[model samples]
Target: MSKSRIIGVILALLGVVLFSAKAVMVKLAYQYDVDAVSLLLLRMLFALPLYLVIAFVKRPKDPEVMKPKVYLWIIGLGVVGYYLASLFDFLGLQYIKASLERIILFVYPTIVLFISRIFFKKLITGSQVLAIGLTYVGVVLAFSLEFSLEGEGLFVGAGLIFLSAITYASYIAGSGWLIPKVGATVFTSYAMIVSCICVLVHYSLVGDFNLMNYGMEVYGLGFAMAVLSTVIPSYLVSYSIKMIGAPSFAVVASFGPISTILLASYFLGETMHWAQWVGTVLVLVGVFFVTKKD
Candidate 1:
């Protein structure tokens, strides 16, 4: 591999690891009695300023103006992708282990494929169908294991995370067209800014605005989550995709569930069953084929 490809691989792996850590961090914050809304609020609040700066600095300089419809698309996708997806993930983590959550969420590629098929009339080959089967079978395997282990809140948490995956996949499906119209950096920054605003608005309506009430540890976790998981990894993944292309980046990103499982084990003391390991492997394999270029 070329030096650029090597660097892209490193960045992709690092970004996946950091992004996986978000679940662990959120789980940690819950120990402080912080609600999902408050924790999500703190995360977006901390990260919002950076996104604003990036949106301004990276605004497209082309003479052509974007249509109002495009702006609406960005806003809608931003809310669905980051705001709602993240809220569901945070709430789900309160019930499920991070390992199981990551495993479930890792199937978004399959969701993306189905979304494209249903909405855009994209054809799914036989292998793609098989890949989908494997992915869901693995998820069911893992979900059953988790449900048995943690009886309370299992269904609700799994349902919420599945919704998170679907909404995120919708964002991915929508953003592909828009990202080229606006540059990747500009599109991502703007989408994130919109997401931050929505999160803030949601918090203001339902959550206490007084963030200072939380202990310092909660703030620290929030800041770490925002900067390390959200901002840095966002840029790293973008740049990695630029360097190595999206196909390679998606393959590299298959390590995400493994990273989360390891992190959850080390940091959160969550143990995985042997069968769950099998499920994780199946998910990784299925998603790999699902995202593999034809």
Candidate 2:
């Protein structure tokens, strides 16, 4: 592997690690009695300033490139990608165990595969094909073992999470245009700013803000989610794509649940079941095969 690609992979892994902390923080947020929209609002609110600083420092001229068409795309991407996607994700999470939800959510790799192939006409190689298959099977194993046929709520939740994955995949694929041009920091900042707007508009419409009056702990966890989960990983993944390309980057991201599960075990008192461990191995192997630099 070239040095740059190696560095890119490292950055991507770091992004994954930052992302793994998301569930725990959300779990913590529940103790403070915040709903999803308000929690999301707070997160974006905290991360927006950071993104602005990064955007300004990294690339001032980038904002000038936000043409009218780009603005439309930005709105579409931000609303559907972040605001809606996040809404669906948290909704699904409420209905299922974190383990089950992560399993459903992480199938985003398969969504990315179809999106890249159908929209971008990116051809899949034999190894890439196997890697993709591994990705699916791995996700199924990870999630299915944790899955329960319990409530109608879980089924409904799974559907929403699947939708969340699709939207998130769209964000990943569509974001390529902006991330490379704007630089990771700047693009993330703007996209997040856009998300904050949509969320605020929705909050205003529902009068959810009146219910969202929060104390310090709520604000702290929300900000932590924004900075630790969204902002940091958003920039890191963009940087990874710039260096290693999206397919390779996404393949590495296929390993997201491993870190999440591990952290859950240590901090959340979750157990590491055998199936989850096997799924983690499969994800690592699939990522290795898919991302092996030629």
Q: Count the backbone clashes (under 3 Å) in each candidate.
A: 0, 0
Alpha-carbon lDDT, every model = 0.87, 0.74
Question: What's the TM-score of each model vs. the native?
Answer: 0.94, 0.85
State residue 288's C-alpha deviation in candidate 2, in Å. Answer: 5.5
lDDT of 1 by residue, 1-294 (tens): 999899989999999999999999999899999999989989998999999998888777774746788789889988998889998999898889899999999988898888888998989989988988999999998888765567879989988889999998888778766666777787778888888999888988988767789899999999999999999897787667667765567679899999999999999999988988999999999989987863
Tell me how candidate 1 scores on lDDT: 0.87
Q: Which regions of candidate 2 are displaced past 4 Å?
A: 56-64, 125-134, 145-150, 280-294
Name model 1 segments beyond 4 Å from true: 1-7, 242-247
What are the clashing pairs of model 1? Answer: none
